[model samples]
Target: MKQILQSLSSGITEIVEIPCPSVKSGHLLICTRSSLVSAGTERMLVEFAQANLLDKARQQPERVRLVLDKMRTDGVIPTLEAVQSKLDQPLPMGYANAGVVLDVGAGVEEFSVGDRIISNGSHAEVVCVPKNLCAKIPDPVTDEAAAFTVLGAIALQGIRLAQPTLGETFVVTGLGLIGLITVQLLQAQGCRVLGIDFDPKKLDLARKFGAQTVDLSRDEDPISAAASLSQGRGIDGVLITAATKSNEPVHQAAQMCRKRGRIVLVGVVGLELSRADFYEKELSFQVSCSYGPGRYDPAYEAEGQDYPLGFVRWTAQRNFEAVLDMLATGRLDVAPLISHRFPLEQAPAAYQLLNSSEPYLGIILEYPDPQQPNDLLNPTIQLEQEHTQTKAFPSESHTKAPIPHQPVLGFIGAGNYATRILIPAFKQTNATLKAVATTGGISGVYAGRKFGFGLATTDPDSLLNDPEINTLVIATRHDSHADYVCKALNAGKYVFVEKPLAIAPDQLDAIQSTYTSILNSGTSPLLMVGFNRRFAPQIQKIKALLANLKEAKAMIMTVNAGAIPPNHWTQDAAIGGGRIIGEACHFIDLLRFLADSPIVSVQTTSLGGVELREDKVSFTLSFADGSLGTVHYLANGHKSFPKERLEIFCAGRILQLDNFRKLKGYGFSGFNSMNLWRQDKGNTACAAAFINAIESGQAAPIPFEEFVEVTRVSFEIAEAARH
Candidate 1:
């Protein structure tokens, strides 16, 4: 499959070949027939990508602040690596597309194979999209017209906000594709419409769509022109659809509206308002989000859930259906809006044509043979010829095989986590680095070059297929951990995977089934999870100190683990296993280490639903030794506040560890002594132990049974909380 991507560093566009993505449950596999290149939206993306480092910094001061804050918390080296990795990633483009279904995933009852669908699937040849993000296309709608579904949804949403009544006067600012579409929809609602834009060509198109068009470039005073057209009463409402960095468009909308008029913004614009204009007219100002009600709601978008039509009349998907409804009848026309078309193979040229102001509107990328189209976009793609030349390390055959005395190491998923934490730590170890594989092109290439790996590939299976690579380190997303681990184990290679062995219980069972066969073999592969907190010097010292206490009856542990936003893909139950399964596992594992006993029961409570507030979760773990541990996972805390604070009560003594940096012990006399700990030493120790265990052919780093038990407890707590 081939996909289009834009390089942020260079602003260059390229179409690269990559492995076709497999369909997942509740997902639709679509072979794209046509995709619309939203000129206003895509042009802004291109310009932002092309900006220099200083210019980019000036444009996004908040992002600059975040980078500086991360440096303070995570230190300099890790922050720098994160920034580099982000820069190296190529961002995918396009959202509105018309395609035919190649196959449907499990539990997708909406469409069947060979059905035409309109979706926000990008400009890819093949796209595996969640079912909710797609809608069925009627037989009457052409591929080009069907591709406008998402854009029409945007326009429909804006119109829905204005709620223009019959005979009401409406003005649409910025006559782009969305602006023109809004003008037509408002006209269909029996509202008198006026359109404003600097582009004479787009103004002409708006006029054809039943709007009274005013060319801002030619008219010195658009406010007067609009008023004169409205017979001096002023328009009832105004929709600003222009994309600009200046707040002038918003100011125009305010000036051109009557008293108590509504001003809805459907495009990206600066919202620095002039208080007098709004105060005098008492106008209502609103920014209509992408599409409508359910656009950014994860449950509605990814989980195939829907809001009742009676209560929520117009959702993002419903907005899409409304657009198709308009097209099905003669109420709305979009065919006249399209100005240019290019085949999928000419995608690079299409971007160039769109970038250059060569008199075009609604440029569409067409696929002649709908059976086979490019599908991979964004995070996945093939390396360009130039990228292929930048060797991360010598090819497999070029590098000599590892000697018997040396431990050969192969890695999968060289993402920021691997580069910043694992690779740097491994550099300090005695293990011989052989290869690193990553789906993203630049990270694998850059890390392989910097760390002197023997090979770099976009495919993890290639690493598994290599004969000389004896060990595998998996740092990919949580959903992929089980399958990758099973493959490595079957290949007779030792395995080390990151936490939360798998996202679901069934996945864990599959991994455990493979474990038995490996154990039956004489040399069972060592399976280790990256639970580095167990190796922290302070934690080790605490365990030793607690071991000597004779009268200790119970222990309480408080973890101030911070919150993650609900929109983050990690919060999605399918992908990241939610916060409890994804992150709470670390705290649970740490508790297991401290208690030195298996957790018998777990209970959880939270203040709000999973989507609203993610920070306020409390968990209690019961150990067989009659000990109890409490974890306070609060999302609302100052960044400057210490992240992790642990307190222990045992044998009439209280011990506290503050942020893993300082520790204090209080004795019976009320005397206290404090100690500061060194950073990086714990991480270094953990990495060294992992490498040594692989080299010596010893037992797993942590007991495999204990690791599985901790995972089970973590999932159980989350499942209980969700119910």
Candidate 2:
């Protein structure tokens, strides 16, 4: 499948071949017919991407602040690399699409194979859209017209906020596509509408859509016209749909609206406001979110759980259906709104026109053979690369490795962590970089070239089943860890999987049974979970310093985890296994390693906060060796604070590690403070251990038993949190 991807580094859009995403449960696999390019929103992203580093920094000062914070804790070199890696990622473009359902996943009954539907899918040849974001198209609506459904929902949502009525007079600030759509929809409600824009062509379209035009290009003032058009009574409401950094739209909206009138913003603009302008009229201002209520809610869109109509009258999907019904009838005419059309292959030229002053309204990208299905849609597309440079290695104790004759590595997932940390670590070893695989072939291409992989592919199963690959690294999503581990164990390959191993008890049981069965069959492939913190040089030094002490140690570990949005996948238990299972396992494992004992028993409790819903929890670990450890993982901390702090005490001697970059020892004879130029979370040692295990035919650095223990403890903590 071919999809349009925008490079943030170069702001270049190219059609690249990638594996068609598999249809997941409650989702539809759609073959795209046409997709709409939202001019206002996409143009901003493109321009931002095209900007220089300094200009980009100027545009998003918040991110710059974050970079500074990272530098303070992680050091300058790591922070710069982090920023560059983020900028190098490919951002998928477009959201309004019309397509035929190629297949439907489990429990998706509303639409099935061959159903022509409109969705919030991107400009891809194939897309797996969640069922809630996918709406069935009416019989009379053409694909191009249906492609406007998602964008139409945006306009409808803004009007919904304005609360227009039959006898009301409303003004739409800006005659863009959304503004024009809002005009027609408001007119359909029997409201007198006036549209404002600097472009005469947009104003002309607004006039054709049954709106009174206020052309700023012709020096027509919207505020004066609104008062005149409303017979000196002032407009009932204003919908600001303009995209600019100027606050003029809101100022004019305030001036045009009557007393106690409503103002809804459906676009981006400078929000500098005068209190007096709004104070005298007591006007209401609201910024309509993307599409509608269910747009950013994970339970609603991702989980396909629709809000009941009795409780929430209009969801994003409901808004999409409403727009489609209007198009099916003659009430809404998007056919005339489309000013330009280009085939999907020439999407770059369409964007160029949108970026230029070429005067386009509803730009649509038509797909070739819209209803046809490719014979090999799910086949793995090998991402071939010409150069595979060996990465440079620093003079480090952990990274130095003996050259191996037959070590082959197949890595799954080429995401940020893998690209920035693990793969780079593995490249310093003697292991042959056999293959790199990811869901998207583009990322695989990038990772393969950068890490010197022999082959880059879209199929993890192919890499796993290959006899040439003796080792496999599973760095994919949390939900996928268990399955990949089981597969690798069954394939007789040494496995290094990132934590946490499993989310559910059944998954853990499956992994344990598979690993045990493989071991019983005289096949002992080393199994290691990515618990890298314990392998850190700072951590190792602490362990050796406390090696002779028999007294129990008391440790306190605080993780100022900051905030992950409630709608992020990390908060979704089914996807990311919640933060505790997905992330806190590292802390749990590190405590066990430092204590030199398994966690005998544990209890957990979470803090409650208003408005900020996150997992702010505390847990106590009672080790078998009589050591006690407490973990305080707080998400409400300020971004400027150092994220992690650990203090351990034994026999009144204290050891402190701050953010893994600096270590301080107190009440001890020969140690004051040990510092590093950059933070090392032991990624180098972690990767080297796994590669060295295969090379030396030795056991894993961290045993499989410890992996199971940490995974079990995490699950228990989550279970306790439920109460």
Candidate 3:
């Protein structure tokens, strides 16, 4: 499928060929007919992308602070690389989409195939949108008109917050698409409206929608206009829908609003407020979220959970429906609002219009009709490289006949961790990069082209069934690890999965059973969990130092795992397996490796609170060799603090590793200190070990039994922490 992508590094907008996304459960696969380009929002994105690095840093001071912190801990080169990698990613554009349901995944009962709908899907020929983000279009509404539904929802949501009443006077401080829509919607509710904008064309459109106008380009004062239009009485409410850095709109909105009146911001503006403008009036100010209530909620949008109609009254999807109803009844007219249209292939020109001085409002991109099938509708496409630079090492081939054990690689995910760490690590090895797969398709294509992968696919099955690929790297979500592991094992291929082999006990049992069956059939391929910290240079030094120790050792691993949002996927128990299993397992495995003993017993202590925060807990592992280790995996720490610290005490000697970059020895001869210019968590070494094992037909780098033991111990620690 050819979809529009904008490069953040170069500010280049183009349509690129990528595999079409497959429909997942609770989602609808829509073949797009039209997608509206949000001028105000998209213009900001394009301008930001086009900005120089220093200007970009000036625009986003918070991200600049984060980069500086990363530099402090992870070193200069890695931090710079991280920032560059983030900028190199392609950003999908557009949200207001109109399409026909080409297919529906399981549990999606709201719309059927052939049903026309409006969604917040991006500018793509095919889009897989959650049911909560989609609403069926009425028969009377045209596809072009329905493409305005999501933007209309944004206006409606802002008005909903304003709580407009009959006979009320309202001022919309911007005559853009959303501003014009707000004008019409407020007029429909029997309210007198005043629209303000610098554009005369937009001001004329607002006047056509029965709104009194104040043209900013003419140096007209909106506050004075509101006073005159409302018969000397202050306006009942003000909706600031203008996009500017000047604080003038907000100050004007405050001055125009009546005492105890509402001011809802539905656009971006400087927020430097004059306290007296709002204090004396006791006015209410609220920044309206995009669309409505269920917009960014994972449960509502991703999991198909809807807000209760009676309690919430209006949700994002409900708002979409309301706007469509208004369009069907002619209460809301969008015909004059659309100023431009372009075919999907001409998306670059449309985006260029946003950056140009040419006036535009509600630019729509039209897609091919569903009846006319095209290659863009296909879920799979071959990625042909103009230059074939991918070379395979002449190592022995194992599973498939005539194919050497040269470790042909198929990566199942191209997420941040995979792209920044795992993929780069593997690219350094002797493995042949075969294909990369991702659910969304954009990142897969990006990673494929950037790393010289033979193919980019949305389907993992195709990669698994390929005869040439003999190794699978599962860097997908935690919930998918075990299933992919079993599948890869059954295919007689080596498996290297990221941490937390399984999220559930039953999943672990299934993986064990699958591996056992493979073992009994004499075709068991190696399975290795990504416990990379154990392979770190510092940790290896610690292991070598402890080799001759005879007494029991005491090891302490303090992880200043910084706080993420409670709603982050890693904190979700079902999806991310919580921090204990998702991340702290690395520490657990590292300690176990240094101790070189089985974890015979375990104990855990959590914070004393009503809400069980597994992220802030401590656990102790009693090893069979009498070596004891405690992992303090606490997220309640400052970001400026070093992230990870390890202290080991064995036989009158001590070793301390700080943030995987520096190590200090205490009371030890010939080894007082060791340090690195950059942080090294052994990611490269781990990848090399796995590849070398496959190439030489040797046992997995870290024993398979140890992988299972570490995973089981992590599960046990989680269970203990819960209580």
Candidate 4:
């Protein structure tokens, strides 16, 4: 379906086509007829996007800080790639839409196919929305009126925050669509309303909505005008619904509100308040969230869960229902709000109207016939021309088809692990990425195009079964890794599988035995496990530096491998094999590499008596060389802290690696030196080593025995901790 996306780097808006999303359980599928274009919200977004890089940074200092933090964590190269991918993604637009239910997903008992529904669906021909965001339209309401339901909810929520009772006087700042709606809703509650705005035309509209208009540009003082209208006592409450960065609106609201009165902010404006005015007045201040109760609660919004009416009278959905009721009872008429309407195909033109300052209000995009043919709603058709002209790379160019060269690679998962580590590393290698597969079609396409992959597919089997693909890099979900590896092996192609080889030890064992059998039969396929720390330059340097220390007694390895949240999918024993098996294996592999000897025994302990189902395990490995290595896999560290920290002690000399960014070597008699390493570019060195191994026809980079031993010890630690 057609969706609008903002480029992360440039923040430019673009329309793109993608697969029609399926309506899952607790979701509703709507074929959009009309959708409201939010002037206040969308204008800000467009202006932000059009700003220069420096201006964008200045506009959002908090977001810039977050980006900087991520860059520090993942390093420059990976962070840049992540930002570019995000920029290339197409986000869906428009939340207030009226449409027909094409279908009802299982567990959605509220509506059926052919029923008219209103929801926060996008400006697309078809949309799959969470059921809680959708409500059935009353027979008397037109589709255009229904499309305004979400906006009405926003206005009602602001009124609810003000809590204006009968005979109370309320002031609404800003005479925009929402401001006008707020005026009418307040009037319905028998409260006298005054609207303030710079635009005379908007003031005219507010006046039509039963509000006394106060033109801020013409009035000598808006506060005095409001106070004079209220018999010099000032208004009972104030609702600031203006959209601007200026603090004037909020200051004006404080001035207009009576002593002990309430002021609710429903607009995007700077809240730089005068402390003395607020302090002396003892006035109540509040910011109303979008819609009403349960706005940000995922259970209520996504799972069709609702709070009891007796306790929580107005939910987001209930707010939507209330707006429809007002429209049906002729209490709130939105006929004057309709200033312009465009077909879905002309959405770009609609945005252009705002940019060009064409006189318009409450612009609506109409998808008259949702079944019409449109390239922006269908990716297959959008890419049809390119697919037809492009030729597939020969199989020999990919693998062992009478050619001895770098292999052509295909990646099956481009998620966080792949984007942040695997793919960035792979970019430094000689291998060519032919295709990338992902469950998110838009992300997969963006990754492939951004990273210069030949193609992208949503189907794993399509890439695996293709003859032109020789080596498969399985970075997908843990449950599917073994199957992809097995398929690649059976296809006579090499495979590189990410950590935790399999969720179950049995599955790991089966793959190991299969590879063993294949090797014995003289038709072995190369298999590499992503134990990247072993290939990290800092870790390797520590190993080489410690090789000649004869006086080194016991080696104490302290690893601050930070924690994963309890709700993370990786914490699931059935799927991710818990953190120990999935992630701690990397630390275990590093310890083995450093020890340079077989581990003789293992022991473990955890902080909390509570453990993951597989348990959040930590291990102590005793090596044959009389060196002790400890792996601490704790789940209670701050996200901003250095993620992987290692300190090694041997014969009065200590070496510490701080999150792979800096290395320090401490010797006897206060002789110590620290060297800062250049930031890691994801796992480029590891990728280069793997490609070098493929080119040289070697038995992978890491020894097979070492891999097996590490896997065995990892499983053993997990089992011990689980009990």
Candidate 5:
């Protein structure tokens, strides 16, 4: 399917054909009819993307600090590579969409095939949207008008927060798409409206929508204008919906609002508040989130968990229904709001206009008959001219397919981890780099060219279905690991996936059942999880020393993991599996490796109650060998401190590994300390081991049963912690 994406590094927008996402449970696959180009939000993104590197850094100081911290832990070279890889990724554009439902995923009951719907899906030919984010379009609304549903909801949410009543006067700053919509909605509530903006065209549209206009470009004093519009009394309330760096909109609204009046902001602007403006008047200020109550709650939006209508009267989807009702009843008019329309192919021209000084109110992108054939939507789309994998190093020139004895590797995800570590490690081995794939074409091509891949594509199944590729390396987000592993095994190829193996027991069960079937058929390929800590040089040395001991070992592992922002994908338990399954699995697997036995039992605890935070946690493991292990994984810690520390005691001897850089041994004669100049967490050795095993037709370095056991332990710990 064709999708539009914007390059944050270069500020370039392009349409690229990529794999269509499969409709997941509780989702609807919609073939887009029209989608709105948000003037205010998209303009902010485009301008931010067009800024210089230093300017971008200044815009996000927190990310800059993260980069500095990475440099101190990881080397400067790797940190630079990760930063470049991040910037090279293209971000998907647009949100408000109107489309016809092509198919409904399992567990969805709201809509079926051929139902027209309005959703917060991006600008694409096809979108797989969660049911909660989609609302059915009434027959009276046209596709172009329905495309404005999400924007109307944005405006309505702010109005809801302001809580205006009949005869109240509300000042709406910035007569852009959202501001104009706000004016009409306020008027519908029987409140007097005053609209403010610098553009005369928008001011005219506001007047058409029943709002008194305040043109700021004509040196109009908004404070006096607002007071006069309120009939010598200050405005009852104010809604600032302007996108600008200047805080004048906020300042003016605070100044013009009547004493003890409410102010709600639904736009992005500088918030340099003055004490007098708010304190003297006793004003109540609130910044409204996009759409409304259930916007970012994964449970509500993604998992189909709806709040009761009586308890929460206006959820995001409820706001959509309200806007549609108004449109159906002839109360809200959107025909006069749309300024321009472009087909999906010419959508680049629409984005170009966003950067220009043109007057655009509600620009819409319409989709016509899809040019792609039906077969292209299949799991695999093959391309001719596959790269020959056996080309020798340039110094030893030979162009031919690699010998069957060697492993031909095709990477499934060219993300930050793969770009910084896994790809670089594979460069040293004799394995063949056949292909690479990512969700976006730019990253796939960029990392492919940089890492010397035979081909690059935006489709995962294209790599999986290729006959020349014999081994698959999975490094995408956490949730998809098990599915990729199963596909590779079924395709008769070896698999190496980063941990944790599976986020849920059901996914693990599927993998186990598949592996068992393969085993019975004598077509099973090796499967390994990248629990690289067990492969560390110091760790192996510790294992060898422990083998000579006569007593069981007690271990303590402390991880100062530090914090990631709450909104990061890794924090989404449904996607990245949260911290326990995503990262703490390493410690769990490492302990199992040292004990050389299965984990017998698990227990866990956390610092927060019912808050569901994975940041601060402690868990204990009981190993079959009678050894006990405790891991204290704390995310709220000093970044400068060593990330990991482990201590082991057995047979009157103590051994400690500190951040994989130093191993200290005590209470043992003739045993000396070991150190490395740089930290080595065993990722390189782990990749090499997996490749060498495949080349030699040997058993996987980490046994498949151990992989399953470690994953179960991680799950148990997380479940116990949450309870």
Candidate 6:
């Protein structure tokens, strides 16, 4: 469907034809009727995008420091490439949306098809939103007004934090869209509202909403006006809804508020506060999160888990419903708040208003009716102009073409790693990119177009059923790896899946059964796990150096895995199988490769008394050849340290590798050290090896036995650590 996308690298906004996203479990597919553009937030993003590199750095000093640290550790070129890739990602615009539900996904019982709803979905003809992020719109609310529900919830959330009461006087600093809405909501709570802004037009609107006005453009003194309005007493509370870098608004708000009164910040502003401004009054200050209680909670929003109404009172979705109810009862009128409207195709022109001097607020982008037939809503798009025919699922009797040894690639994911590393690596190997599929179609289309894929699709079955595709690359989430591998193998295709081939023992058993069946059919298609570290140049040198060793080797691998929030998807045991199985498996496979022997036994130990203790653990492996290796995966270390360090002690000699960039040997014949200008994690070499194996009909780059062995040991380590 047509969607508005902004380029952070070039600051360009355009309407692009994106494939309609497929509805996932607990999600609803909606056909948008209208969407509201957030002026303040989007304007800030556009300004940042338009600024020069130096200005951008100045705006985000923290990010600049991170970049400098990365350059120091990983070198300049790779750091710059990572930054460029991040900027190259297309950002979808608009969040406040009013739409009709086109379809309901599994487990979604709240809304049915044809239900009118409001959501924080982006500006697209079709949007797939989680049920918790969507609320049914009232019958009395029009689509245009319903588009303001999310914004109203933002305002109401701020008011909720302020805890305004009857006869209390409150000041809303910044009479923009949110500010005006906050003024109306506070007045609805029986509070006297005073609005402050530099714009006379906005102040007039605030006045129309029954709020006393203070126009900064007229050089009015807001503190004096508020003091007089409160009859020598300071105002009851103040809500700073202004977006600025100046600290004056907060200072003035502190002066205007009465003793022990509350101040809630619902917008961006400078935070350098004078100690006396808050110390004498013992005032309470809180920064309101967007929407409400469940704003950024993945379980609440993504997983459709709702907060108990009796305990939490109001959540982000509940706030949305409250705003819609107010709209139904005519308590919150948004008709006058809409300053402009534009069609979805003219979104670029609408964003232009943000940069222009033209006065605009609550700008709405309208979409085509769901009843209309729009070709843009197709689930698949042909990225290559010459690829005219789209192959459907072929029957078993379909004519089989002579299989060439060349690798024809179909990718199952277009995530950050796949787009920045895997796909580019395969592209350099001259692999024919057949198609790329993603649940959300944006990244698939982006990767397909950028890497010259013949087609981009939202369906994986399409890629698996295509006869021309000989190899399937699985870069999807950890939990989905085994399923994709089994399916690809059953389709008579070679498989190259990212690390940790299976998250569970049962999944490994299922994959083993599938592979055994495939082997019984007299064809052994290559099944390789993406243990790319073993392919690193330094690693290869270490492997060769260890090959001649007569004595047993002892290896130590220390990984500063870094801290990830407990709520991150990777930390979820069911999804990512914890860090040991998801990531530390790379070191397991690397050690296995260097030992050139099967892992016979494993032991694990983890930190105690922490929620995510498994992430900071040590695992030891005993190789059949008398080699022993210990992997210390610690997420508690500081970021400035080297991320990964590996040391080997064998035959009265020592070899060390640091962050895949440098290798040093001690007590060796002639080798002193080897270093590179940039870090190489063997991504390109890994892809090349896989492609070469396919072309030459050689064994899989890494044997399927080793893949299964490493994966099983990883699961064992994670289980032991958890216990």
Per-residue error at 504 for model 3, in Å? 1.2
Clashing pairs in 2: none
What lDDT tens digits, residue by residue, belong to model 6 across residues 1-723? 788888888899878776788889999999899999999999998898888788988999999988988887788999899988988888988889998898889999989998999999999988999999999998999999999999999999999999999999999999888999999999899999899999999999999999999989999999899998788799999999999999998999999989998999999999999889999999999999999998899998888889988999999999999999999999999999999999888889999999999999889888867556344458887664322333322233236652588777899999999999999888888577778899988888788777778778888888899888889999999999999999999999989999879999999999999999989899977988888999999999998887888898999999999999999999898999999999999999999998999999998889998878789999889999999999999999977788899999999999999999989999888888989989999999999999999989898989888889898899889999888
Q: Mind giving the per-residue lDDT tens digits that candidate 5 earns over 1-723?
A: 678888888889888665566677899888898999999888888888898899999999999998898777655665676787678667889999999888888999878888999999999888878899999999999998899999999999999999999999999998888898899999999999999999998899899889888888898888888888888878989998998889888889988889899999999889999988999999999999989899998789878999998999999999999999988887999888889999899999999899898778789898886564343343322222323343322312224544675888888887768877788788678787767777644455545656667566667887787677778899899999999999999998889898879999999999999999999997756999989988888898888888888677899999999888776777777888888999999999999888887788887879885354576899889888889899999988888677899999888889998888789999877787988767778888999998888778799998889989989888888877666
Clashing residue pairs, backbone N/CA/C < 3 A, model 6:
none
The model with the greater lDDT, 3 or 4, is: 3
lDDT of 2 at 557: 98
Candidates in order have lDDT scores of 0.78, 0.86, 0.90, 0.76, 0.84, 0.89
* lDDT of each residue in 135-226, candidate 2, tens digit only: 99999999999999998999999999999999899999987889888999999999999999888888888888888888787898787899
Candidate 2 achieves a global lDDT of: 0.86
User: Which scores higher on TM-score, 1 or 5?
Assistant: 5
RMSD of 1: 5.4
How well does each candidate superpose onto the true structure, as a TM-score? 0.80, 0.93, 0.97, 0.80, 0.85, 0.97
Superposed on all Cα atoms, the candidates' RMSDs to the truth, in angstroms, are 5.4, 4.3, 2.2, 5.3, 4.7, 2.8
Candidate 2 lDDT trough over 10 residues, lowest sum? 391-400
Poorly placed runs, candidate 1 (over 4 Å): 274-282, 308-313, 325-331, 340-346, 353-359, 368-493, 502-523, 535-560, 566-578, 591-632, 645-688, 712-723
Which digits, one per residue and each the tens of the lDDT, describe model 3 over residues 61-93?
999998998889888989999999999989998
Q: Quote the RMSD, in angstroms, for model 2.
A: 4.3
What TM-score, to 2 decimals, does candidate 5 have? Answer: 0.85
Name the weakest run of 10 consecutive residues (lDDT summed) in model 5: 378-387
